[model samples]
Target chain A: MTLTWDMQDAKSTDDRDVVLEVKDLRVHYATPLGDVIACNGISFKVYEGETVGLVGESGCGKTTTAMGVLRLVQPPGRIVEGEVLLDGVDVLSLNEEELRRVRWNQISLIPQGAMNSLNPVMRVKDQIGDAIQTHESRAREAVKERILELLNLVGLPARVYNMYPHELSGGMKQRVCIAMAIALNPSLVIADEFTSALDVIVQRVVAQTMLDVKDRLGMSMILIGHDMGLQAQLVDRIAVMYAGNIVEIAPVEDIFEESLHPYTQLLIESIPSIKERKPLKVTEGLTHDLRNPPPGCIFQFRCPYVMEHCREVEPPLRELKPLHEVACHLFEEQDGKIVDISDESVV
Target chain B: MRGLTPGYLIRRLGMFVLTVWLGATLIFIIPRLAPSDPVAAMVSRLLAQSGSVEGSAEMIEAWRARFGLDAPPLIQYLRYMRNMLTFNLGYSLTSFPSEVEDMVVRALPWTLGVLSIATVVSFVLGNTVGALLAWRRTPGLVRTLLPLSFTFTAIPFFMLGILLIYIFAFGLDWFPVSGAYGRALTHNWNWEFVKSVIHHGTLPALSIVVTSMGFWGLGMRGMMITTDGEDYMILAQAKGLHPRRIFWLYGVRNALLPQFTALALNLGLIAGGSVLVEYIFAYPGMGYLLYQGIVNTDYTLIQGIVFIMIMGTALGVLMIDLLYPFIDPRITYETR
Candidate 1:
């Protein structure tokens, strides 16, 4: 019956346009003692023309996951195992030259710190021109026009074309990075906390510029950051990572309203609310060492609702509802609704 | 573009002039501070040579009068400053009738030709080796071998000169051991003179280059390492730029800024620092002239050489100051 259905599914649909697919991607940083698993076999797919927010607290492998996808992790950090499929091509399998050709042309990056992402000595035009010229050799005038077009697309003035990175303001620099990321009109762009270094007002402006550009260019993006507020404003789907593994991933509203995993629920509660006065939620336990994670769930040590089964068996990410996935042992699908099996009574 | 304003230029030039003035005054005061007078010292050497010359006291007085030493201290200072401005340095005490200006002019070309070549070669070679050593993508064998080239830096350049002379001159008989050119070649503007000069100056130049390149290499390696961690470098890689392009345009270009500043300082000190090397090789340059002046207590010659050195150094610093804004756009003088 499955084979017959597979034959009938030969034509691809528009909604299933998976621009980037990261499967079982494991990244590790080699230390003297052992490998510290930064991204532990995390998998996700980014559909075309949508933003996926990889959200977690600092050091929870959000940035590592982005770097792993770009193949830009520095020394001591190694992509131990994984396949980063950009437009159905395995990025990990490419040679250096081949990989270089694939980068920026198909997948560009708006780096973590926009303040230093640009070459200080280089002019804004040259830095943006580098991305475009590397992939396709265009006439000088054409390249210049395209660069100015990109700057305008990101809501920057034309005079910025001649200015060095030092001459620009922080928001302008972040916008410059955003402009460069879209210079080549890449299929997938990874923006790693692109606005984390800006003021709140500037952050909003830059975020709006990003959204406008992404909409105009019709590009898919992975926005990596810990700002839940920003994620809510920008991203379509949110992947909440904990201890190097994505614990829960779902549509934006559902994760905010009906998060399944205990870690996800705590994360939602931790979001600061201005309307009500409540005691701050302080998690009790510390995170386990990444180099030596326990034999059960990654969040077991910090999970407030930890149980006997959670301590002995590692839980796999399972789809408990349509488009919502959770990695916790307490929840089970029963009668078309997720129910707490451990409660021993119906709610 | 904004830094090369006329006011900034004038201020920079004013600073250069101040440096030269202070340096000139110090050199003048320092020589006079010594207990022995140049005339008296000359007389004593003559007396020792001829076993008590007749009327030595009269001769000393007559010589002092001829050399304008009979003037008061203030008069002497005014005269000295006047002569310095006019480029009319007095006759050497030991080599009378041979003006200090002529001696310097004759020696200047040889020193500039060889030393400049050596300095530029060492800087380029050292920086390249250093950059490659720190670069992550450089081949291991190349990195390993590059460090061995800079080992000569541990040895004094004169010592290296002697070693080169011993191996290449005495042992192999491939090159001349001493002097700026072969005895057979006349000093003229011709290919033979240039070739013979190069052939003879090889050992001295090689000694300086090989010994000093390691300093530049070590400095460049440190800078390259620091530049490697810059956010731009990672972003450049992420942009899919060619590795060679990133290494040169981003990595080496930024690392080379401090090295250029150091180069200017090294260039300023070149004339003074080559003394030992020149002494060992008997190369007739400013350093050799300096050695002669020191040994003979030729006050005029020494003063001339020191003034020229001060001028060269101040000029070098001024040039670098003006060129800095072009090199690093962030260093604009327009704000001030």
Candidate 2:
């Protein structure tokens, strides 16, 4: 059975069926003090065969959201409230057995730190074969054959199957991880900082391999990264998240060119490009703590174009133009004010 | 086979020589430094009982000459080293009628047999239990059982030996109380004698097992927990491996590597049996032989037993060093 769904509104001409839909997701971690709302009522959707880039600073709940979807969160950190509908079924509602069936077969995760993810004592082939044997019923010989096929798919020679993890280089290990993630041909794959550990040159190759795999497998991806330039080259749509809330969602070109949200604009301006010889503008103030989020908007302290209304009341996400959404009071007409402030005041 | 580096081997050999020299000095000097001369004491007692000085000086001189006690301390030490090099372990002072070699030869096999069985059983049981508890998010019953198993290891071997004797020998009467065999067969080497010997050896063997089993279990458990946290285990899970496969193939296999080294060390040190435990159980093992030598001041027998223990431990360490590269390809004798 094909496990895929659509999440695009009827207004857009590029409406593809949604592969995954996350609605009103509220995942809180019970700390010593109280509930630290990691993902506070956040919502988004990914369409079939589309790459959605989740860009945010550290501790902004991007990684937590991904882990929550996979049900990989350990104790004290939990998905307190949410609907993670994969295809049509709510993943959060599934029991352990049901979760096991869908985990690698329907949706796979390329976890963070690829280099350390493999067993040093085991042969790489046996490690890969383990996954195949877990979700499928096959003979030992057949599993061995499938492992070889997977190695070939990930651009690794079959010889790597007999070698241990320590024998392989960093790049080779990451490739093996990629191969392992796609061993089951899952419809949706989440690549969580997969290329973050490699050198710049290796990162490029690994990133390109991820894109190539997605193209070949015809799979949708939720690429979570802090590197905006890398995401621009790979992801089809970018969702700019700050303090556990996506402040902007737009096509890659729109995000780079006409970013409606001030935070998104600042983020894009910060990226060092050859043509843009201007000094890279960095947003002032560190990322806010998610435990006790500010009164209204989470980004009020860091937002350069923050208004009094932005601090007192939260701005709901509103469409500024076709296929572009922003959650800022300045963009909307509120109480007869255009709300555009002078550039000096923001500086 | 890289073996040990030339420099490392030289260092180890130098250390071995130094240890032997120090051990010999301490053994000989402590006896001499005592307030009373043992030979003089023996002669004085003999005179007191007989009430005669007839052949007293000649008898003392003969005793001194026979054992090389008449020589200077340095000369005696040199003679001891020469005899050690020639593999002539000299005669026992207590077992003057019988040779020290005969005593050690007769005791060695019994000690090895019981200790070997106990060590192997403890390792298997401890490691299996530890691995299972570590790999599984165990229930409260298993958690309770684990701490209780560790309790057996916490008690001293000799104390446990006495406890087992009181319970099994006196209270419940399941096993024989003491000795290698029943008094019925003195010269018989048949199955009946062998069975009785094994039955009597059980309590002492169990004492060693209880005292050492917790170490293996705790080691395996710690290693398994660390291995579980490793990237490879997560990778295995990510690869869609079944929980069982993850537990055995990834968890247990990697965890067993360090535990194997501990087991090998235990095997090497087994030659030095628990002296107190052997005494309590009255088992005719090396420990009992060593204890008898110490009590009777049989320097030759004590030196012989200590030498065997040192060699056994050294050989065990050497075996582990050689086997390391075979078990873990990442480890290299030259590099690390």
Candidate 3:
């Protein structure tokens, strides 16, 4: 049986269901020196059948944020405090049994490295079947048929059912992971750098498979990656993270067209183009130490329009426009127009 | 065989034969290089027993011809290889008229029974202990107590055997001091004899298992830790499979691959038994036979036992090589 959601029915932001809501989520990695703030009080929401791209540079806690939301952060990293409410259920407060039942059934993960994400010794069917079988028991024949169907859903051949993970190509392995994540049709799927290891051609194929599977299943997704171009093409909205904090988040077009945060501006400028050769725009500041962040806006040191007040007060994430939020002190909404309020000398 | 190509199987078996041949040739040459003649040594012993012997030179010459010592070294080497091919180890030097193979046959069962059981028990117990040691969910008391089990690994097995014999055999009188079975019982498959055999075999087997299990446990612990950190391990946890399933299937299954190769090599040593442990217990196994052969300088007996051990080891490696692809689908001999 096919489950379809009418795209036209829930067009309004108010009418759409919030499938996932991550609020004040903080994850820390323990060390002898101190705790490294990996995901520093990050918050976001994914509406029903919406894809929110969490894009950032390497080590900016995009994966950690997803892990924290899924309650899969490994030690010496732990979710210190916050709420990860999936479908209005408080995931952090659930007992072990309850948490397990929720995982992969309500929210599955297509991990960062698809090549290594699968158990090498197990066959493809078994790996896909494991996710399905863990939450519910079914007849062996039915499980086999369902696994074959899942392989087909991801555009993989039926022969892949009997093959081990190593037998499949990288793209095929990625599709297997995608199929596995959507096996139970979880409401939300977290794809963490899912296409990073693949070549450009394979990346496109795997990305297409993910989009196809996601559309057919109509699941909410948090696609965590660093590919600005890919994010622009695939996601409805984009969240730009820096130094363990989301510097800016908006509809993809708004993010690309009129980005508010300074870091987002630099990120857009850095996207390589094939048409012309331009000097690379390299922002000239290292990220502050994660264990001890500076007491202000995280991007203050790198922002071109840094002000005296920006160094002392941590800029809160504020909604300055419809469905657009930015964490910066440079601009303010005046009569529905974002006006540059920074000191002229600093600009 | 299912995973192995005919070419790979032939190559592997060929390698096994080459190993046995090399071992046999080395043993033959090394003993010859020592400059001690077995016949001369036997004659000297006889001379020491008697004040004078009539025509001892002539007797020596006749015996040398009879034993084929008169042949050139090259001829002797060829004959030795030919005999090895057919498993035709000659008569023991000290214990004349007894065929080396017959004695080995008599001792083989005891060694295989005791050591094989010990090897398997130690491997299983050690790996289980190791997996538990590395497992995050293991109970507090178990984690504390598991290291104590490895304490015996630090001591040599024979020394542990001595300690066991002193405590359980001598002090408590719970079992016999030495031998493979009770003196009163006849060798049979009946319960009383079997029980007695187990009783007698306990300390020797216990010494081996207790001492060697720590090595296995430590290796397994290291592998389990590495396997636990693999990317699939995190995905397995995220899959929300029960902790037990993850521990055994995802964790232990992958961790156990290297250990299987180790177990194969260890199984090769079974034909030799623990030379010292068997000596200490006076158990009638290959180790005890080897000890007697060394003491008496019975070249044929020593050669026969060593050859059996070499064959056993080569056979073990071959079996593992052929079977590896079946256990781990990733390993394929078809490529080789």
Candidate 4:
């Protein structure tokens, strides 16, 4: 089924609408022992020109959800039981022929480790030209011209066209990847942990460069990162995932200030802020295994305010306030009315 | 930084000369150090041909002087080095009528023709099929062929050669039993001669091809499997490149770096033809000549053949070093 986002909730001041909506996207990997559920019913939406960040610690299935959105997950890790609606076309259902047409033209990916993401043996121009060459038979001059334009767009020199990947620095190679990603002017770009491998300074530069490119091109994006601070600086909305489930999602401002999910609150507190220098709060338990997850709320084991019923029943993601959603039994109180945890009376 | 500089070229050329010189010295000295003197046999033969005591001493002196055996060992070695430096290897002791150069030139084509073609064909075909097998996406009989390829590689070349000879030569009678061409056809530039040459060369060529193709295929497959793990491979796929383009352009191109060196060294391996197999097939190649040179202790012939081997391998190494930069961008020729 096509994943649908209600128009009222999709309302934004910028007047853009949803370009990508992932609903109940469950990606599982089959191993010798058993099946590991990487992404269990994950869902999110990216509106036009919006940067939706999927923030989580490593192995929390953030990349898997992004791979699902692009239909690029390989064998043994299948995107099972999901709808990845890119511009209303279920990318999950597209055959090889149809997917070829959509991939890199309508949607592209700036893969993780862009430093080595390019073909090392090929020149930067040829590597970038591969995207154009695959979708359409463009002229050599046109390809060269497009590569130069893309290099210009990514702040790379035209001389990089003939250089191999080994000749470029880590940051330069990443820029080349950005150029290739937007070569076709795809409507959506997925940046999967793109800045995780860069230094703090280069990270900011590349992240801003990506934002500048996004602003100039007016494309939607799904940026996956573990750093909430990094996500806050760039994305409009943040979907904080835990153990293959989106525990909380709201505007970047609200995710930090008015986070209804305890996990999100803990995550925000756990960041060692330079302004405060407070001792970082560490979560007490290992993440639940996807192979055999608990029967009830996945976070109940580590959750501080776990109710008796939370151990037995799963809590669906419910909207506790305008544009703020949290999956927690704590929100299921006071006769279905939303409870403000910050208010002293609730404690 | 990676440009081919004059200094680097000069250094490599110097290295090539040093290697050839060392090889020539060892071959020249090792045979002299042997217990039995090859020159003594020729001297005794010369003495037997003379009538008797009358002018026998003069005849012995003439034979020794002709072969440079009358001089001190060190002087003889120096003279031999100078002769080899000028491309003169004297006459074969066993086949005294022919010069060492003449015999080697006559035997060159048989070894080069069959082995060179077999090696190149196997390299191309094996590497292509190997890249396909390790691509991991497409499936159909690749896994089945995997074990078989490894098994084929594990089998020794001579054993495989013997097996092919047994099956195709003896059992089916499909190809010639031995030799480079029909004895009836004289070596010429005509189609008939070429056709007969190929016809007789098929079995030996097949022996080399079957034994060697497996090694190249196995090597490339391993390299491809390693390359498949490289992030560029995923990047190529994400670029929406066709499976075929990615297989060749990204996968095989990178996978070829190691295999290319193997191919260059295979040039050396080409000249060192299968002595046992060539002997069994009675092919008139360097290997057969090498066998005869060793058995008869034809010092001049042995030294000549060994010199060719040393030159062939040294050239192969030099070619590999020169082409490495082109194959892999990481290899740069830096100035000292």
Name the top DockQ candidate. 1
Q: Give the per-residue lDDT digits (tens) of candidate 4, residues B96-170.
A: 889989888888778998888988888987887777778786577766665565466677777887888889888
Tell me the tens digit of each residue's lDDT in model 4 across A177-251. Answer: 999999999989999988888999999888889988988998988899988788888898899898899988888
Q: Which of 2 and 3 is ahead in lDDT?
A: 3
Give fnat (model 4): 0.73
Overall local distance difference test of candidate 1: 0.89
Q: Is candidate 1 or candidate 4 better by TM-score?
A: 1
Judge the docking of candidate 2 as incorrect, acceptable, medium or high. Answer: medium
Off by over 4 Å in 4: A1-15, A332-337, A340-347, B41-62, B142-150
lDDT of 3 at A261: 91
lDDT of 2 by residue, A1-347 (tens): 01111222534545577788888787889989888888877677788999999998788888888877777765578888888989988989997678878888888888788888877766788777767777898999998888888888878888898988887988889999899888888889998988988999999888888878888988889999999999999999898888778888888998997777888888877788887579867778876676888787778887876778888987776655556767777774335333444432221
Summarize candidate 1's per-residue lDDT along A197-296 as a digit string, tens digits: 9999999999999888877888999999888999998999999999899998888998888888888888888988999988889888988999999998
- TM-score of candidate 4 relative to the true fold: 0.93
In order of lDDT, best first, we have 3, 1, 4, 2
Model 3 chain A poorest ten-residue lDDT run: A1-10
C-alpha lDDT score of every prediction, in listed order: 0.89, 0.79, 0.90, 0.83
| Residue A330, candidate 3: C-alpha displacement in angstroms | 0.8
Sorted by TM-score (best first), the order is: 1, 3, 4, 2
Error of 3 at B248 (Å): 0.9
What does candidate 3's lDDT look like per residue over A1-347, in tens digits?
00001211233345689999888899999999999999998887899999999998999999999989889888899999999989999999999999999999999999998888899899988888888888989998999999999999999999999999988999999999898998898999999989999999999998988888877888899999999999997899999999899888889999999998989999999999999999999998888999999998888778788889999998888777777888888887777678788642222
Off by over 4 Å in 2: A1-8, A13-15, A139-141, A275-277, A318-323, A333-347, B1-56, B68-88, B128-136, B185-194, B334-336
Each candidate's fnat, in order? Answer: 0.82, 0.56, 0.78, 0.73
Instruction: Please write out the lDDT profile of model 1 over residues B245-274, one tens digit for every residue.
Output: 999999999999999999998788765548
